[model samples]
Target chain A: MAFRLIHASDLHLGRRFANIPQPPDGNIRGRLMEARHASISRIAKVAHDRNAKHILLAGDTFDTATPSDSVVRQALTAMGENADIHWWLLPGNHDNLKDAEPLWETITRDAPANVHALADASAVELAPKIFLFPCPVAFRSSGRDLTANLMDIPATKGALRIGLAHGGVVDLPTAVLTFRPTETVAPGSIILRLATGTDVSKSAIAHIIAAAPNRIGSSMDGAVSA
Target chain B: MTLEGPGAPPTVEEVETGAFLWINTELPLLPNTDCARALEAVLPDEGRRDILIRVRATGWASLQQQADLRQAAARLGPDFAHFDFDTNMLGTTYDDADLDDIDKAGALRLAANRLKEGTESETLSAEERAVSAGALARLYAYVKEAAE
Candidate 1:
């Protein structure tokens, strides 16, 4: 069965939008913070509207492993709000599974019944003929290619397989948005990690849905394949 | 003064207390671009100054672009005595100054003063300080270039 999925990654839900130049009265920080929640809301709306059975969050759902309690609460609430959509959130480099009590753990503890935090690399059946493989980012930078194991998993008969992952690769038939929080500063020079692109301002999940059919979706320079 | 735009390079101004620059555009600070050249032309290589760059852009600059700006700033280190920029993002604005009497070089000199009160500030978190310092360096380079 051909399944529709909303693939997004690198939500960076609690990132500090620091040192940005804006009008003194403009609510850039608040707007940015709200934007994160809006991305989730948008995902829920689109998932419901598109009749998508699953929402695949490849990785980096939270900006840090130890996100504030409020952020955790808000994220879970958003997931709970969309109870009909199944959410598969994979841990990324930013929210890696190395920590004993990482953000994923907190999420799993607090998430709604519809949400599943994928901390291990594994495969599961989404529907009768739909199989899913989640490649969890175990560390910030790992020597192992997270998605390599997907090929070894024997396919179930008549199943359509989908793979989800985060990070960069040279050749992929997907559009990638890499968010580098820091840049290497040359001697006597400096650099700031400024917010740019639709990834932060708008819902890349929506962008993927709008650009679907011919496009593969990814975030933070990672790729998701159907 | 607040510089609003469809994304242009920053401009320079001298205030009564010190000098400053304002970026009112929305273009990414990509290297070898007009915005880069505009920044280069507005900053000056001169005496002690306390410059606050009020960046009001909403553009997302790529890592490569930021790295290129860093490279340019490294080339013009000695020309500047000091540098600083606002630590707040979005919702902070820079007041405009009447710089009619001041020449371009004079304005840059005043802007490129000692880098902040000190290298490290107690008000800023370590990450903020580092980010602020690097942004200041990029701003200073543009000021040096523009002021000259």
Candidate 2:
């Protein structure tokens, strides 16, 4: 049973607003964030309109370690618009602060059911064939990779196993685009995580992780059969 | 990783990562604890495990989120780039700037050849990377450093 997900990251809302004040499209906060949010809204609308089951936010929805109140409100409003969909924001390292940034807590407080912000690694059975795990950077860890932190992610028998996260791909430093394939499952299992190769520095992320395969980044940097 | 305070003379190791953090001997460090706190503030605490926190070369955090790991860090240097902290399976060819060439390149070629041999294999194209990437990168890096 193959379903669809929105694998978006680095929103950095209210962060620096890169390279510009306004876009040719007349949107504010840099073309990137606006473009992403626009796409997210579109995805939400699509999910709502199509009744999609899941909406995965890999990480960095907010720009700062401490996102501003309005920024939090804006995120909530945008997500709230998609009342029907199961909106989940796996706290990226940037957004996952020592304390729950007002931005996220606000959402949790406002919409308990609609918004699920898992700030750490958790195995939640979203569907019958899919056992999804999200690794959120809820706190500070030194000298360790968070993806490989858990025990046996990418379940043994499942049609789809996904990991939503907000970190770059590991090991291969030369290639910034992380679509080199990874190992979230055992040696020969057809499992997949919905990330664009996990590297944030490259462009193939959207095309590789989000498009077609519907893959997102997993902390595990191994190869999966899928 | 060396522990440092804010606005203190960074250790020789810290200087290596090329943080561009100025070394001011005159002001001196406020204190090691203070420095640690300040440096701690620089990195996001969201995902603590994957952030490779080291002190030797200017206080910095290198996060490995598994997929697209280090993408943002490489994109906007010194910017507040958000990266996931994954400790799971490691890519066969990733080298820190600090390692030497012979060691680094040696690792790469060995891994690549190992993959090519298809003897004791694991992960994606270990053969492809083991041939040289992570290792040679370190070697090339050393040569460049030596030339400098």
Candidate 3:
């Protein structure tokens, strides 16, 4: 049986959705702001329901590198509450490795046992035969493919190799317009873009993984569910 | 095509071929009231009309704005045939598809198909071809940006 995992990223917590007009008396506004946390809780519920032992977050867990104390505390509390699900948090462009030291420190200090920050760009086993290679973003806009070294990751026979990352997959412009490049690629791993405000449909993700029990590739693996 | 007052007589300017009414503007999106008024101004009050509104602009649209516009469109009923922001705005072009539904592999394949048609088709203008190509690229970027 394959190791069940839920991949998600670009949480962008504490983001002041400024364009969305804040209602008077701040009731709806509060709910709108708290929606991000609600989303996290929803993700946790997805993990619990799907029997996903691991929820791999590619990056940008927080909207800002140094989020407010309350935001940080709230996020940490949520992680603490969902202690059973393994959370693999990777540093992304918004939460760069070098810049967000204090925040990372706060996370490591208060985070539960299940939470793991994939700060280093190396291979680590999620299960006996399931290996995860995370290429965390060191800088905000490093003009280099973070997953360039993913192919070099030593292959373990019969092992499920999954790469967790953040940023864009296709970097070059294709006659359209100048597509902004970011460091969010893990070559061998199936790259799933989790943009801001996208409700990470747990059922869909689970279905995709369940369908491709052997390996999830860069293809229409979710067509059955789609 | 200017956005005149509500009671202003309908005056449509043809940008491309066919029965399309192109309203060239600099603003990203029309205000809710303005949008409704514009709709009323363009569409004939009685009978069926294949009203195509193409809002051409170097405009900006937020995710919320798009949602609001969509809501406005829904409320306006099926009076208009097709109402979309100009493809120039990423919000207008690649915003319809719930990219999460299709995998990167499938999207790429479909994009390839569209691109092939876009490049090979002789009847399509340079602008149409460019828009088609841009749509795919933007789609790829968006899907990858927020894939699960």
- Which one wins on lDDT? 3
Q: State iRMS for model 1.
A: 23.9
Score candidate 2 by DockQ: 0.01
Candidate 2 per-residue lDDT, tens place, A31-63, comes to 334443454566576565545667776766665
Global lDDT of model 2: 0.43
Q: Tell me how each candidate scores on DockQ against the true complex.
A: 0.03, 0.01, 0.02
**lDDT (10s digit) by residue, model 1, range A143-163:** 766665544455344344455
Model 2: chain A TM-score against the true structure: 0.66
Give the interface RMSD values of the models in order.
23.9, 23.4, 26.9
Candidate 2 docking band = incorrect
In terms of TM-score, the best-performing candidate is: 3
Query: Which tens-of-lDDT digit does each residue in B10-114 have in candidate 2?
Result: 121100111111111111122122433333445544433212222222322211111122333334223322222232232323334323322346765454344
How many clashing pairs per prediction, in order? Answer: 26, 66, 8
Query: What lDDT tens digits, residue by residue, belong to model 3 across residues A98-131?
Result: 8988888878777788888888876777777567
For residue A34, give model 2's deviation from the true position in Å: 5.4
Q: For each candidate, what is the lDDT?
A: 0.48, 0.43, 0.52
- Ranked by lDDT, top first: 3, 1, 2
